[model samples]
Target: MKNNRLYAQFSTGYRAPQTTELFRLQAGQTIAELDAENINSIELGLRGQVESLFYDVTLFSMHKDNFIFQDTNRQNISNGETSHRGIELAINYQWQYFYVAANGTFAKHRYDTNLTLSRINIQDNEIDTAPEHIGSVQLGLRSDLGEFVELEWVHQGNCYINPENSSEYSGHNLLNLRTGIRLSERLDIGIRVSNLTDEDYAERDDFGFGSYRYFVGEPRTVYATVQYQY
Candidate 1:
């Protein structure tokens, strides 16, 4: 492993179906029985610092059974099964007063079985909110005088909006700027301006009530903060 660290891990997880999801009777539909979902996962990772650069990489896979999800018909269902596999990477470097940091993830989350929904068998479809790619990069200036300024770019790849894979939320990218200064050993101040480009986007999207709707993402905004450490 030299100057790096390598590790492997296995874990199990469980989640009970939400009470509201299970008992919220809609119209004339009867409440259906639901079961807790379970997952088994394995992960392998390597982390280390090489000179001024620091990096960590990880690969992971998970198998989930009786996965609970909301259906297109607005009913909660425990589908057959699903699998998720992914890789994540992070790196940071500093050269004098200038530095950069970046991280990214690429993954696939898909059905591992033919799930019967509304008299249809759907298999190998991507899940909602599970984009195939997501990443962020930040470049900054820092000094011994306790001052720093940074700009960051964030990105998300296109993702399906429902289990039927009928629609997509065509991804988005955002820019943000931040700066801070230390007034004293125990006092500091900072300002952040997010969505620097004022791009229009949506945090979530879905088809409901025979129409498409979205929760609009936040627009360009600014704020300041002050901190006093005891």
Candidate 2:
């Protein structure tokens, strides 16, 4: 308990209907009828340091009333209720010339009450495109000469692609590499390679109108940057 801390929090949130949701007319309608969204949340957390290692963890739950969303017809509507719950973790460690850090979230986003959308019943169903797992880890090394390099791995877990929960998108993983050096007292140089493995995956996926659609992720790419302080 010497280097540890525990905390708890409760919060509330509110969001008024957006102009598009209020002003956009649906077929044969002058204006869409929508209500503002309100949410209540609770969270518990712990953080501490053990020697050279530091870590933090949290658990959270949130509930919302009148959750606003667009139906398959692209018309704005409000769901009666929705719930979100999750756990998150972060850790870091360092020793001499090397260091590592990682963070992640595991969560569920669900409709809490039975509702009809686009002629479909969605009750206690996971929200479409809401991945349950997402996280990244990074390892790096540095020297007293102001040079450093890092390698990172990113991950996304699978999720439903449609409100029906019948279609899913198998998630993806990617690797990235970056290095930088202080070129001079006023300058710095850096290079980065994203999607290092050139993996093929979709940045986004959707199922609609009897079809599955995808927005492809970027291929491996390299970037260079030089910064000068004025």
Candidate 1 lDDT score at position 19: 84
What lDDT score belongs to each candidate, Candidate 1 first?
Answer: 0.87, 0.91
Ten-residue stretch with the least lDDT total in model 1: 113-122
My TM-score estimates for the predictions, one after another, are 0.89, 0.94
lDDT of 1 by residue, 122-207 (tens): 68888766899999999999989879999999998899876678889999999999999999999999999999999999887876
lDDT, residue 129, model 2: 92
lDDT of 2 by residue, 82-165 (tens): 899999999999999999999999999998876565467789899889999999999999999889999999999999998889
Q: Relative to the unseen true structure, what is the C-alpha lDDT of residue 82 in candidate 2, on a scale of 0 to 100?
A: 87
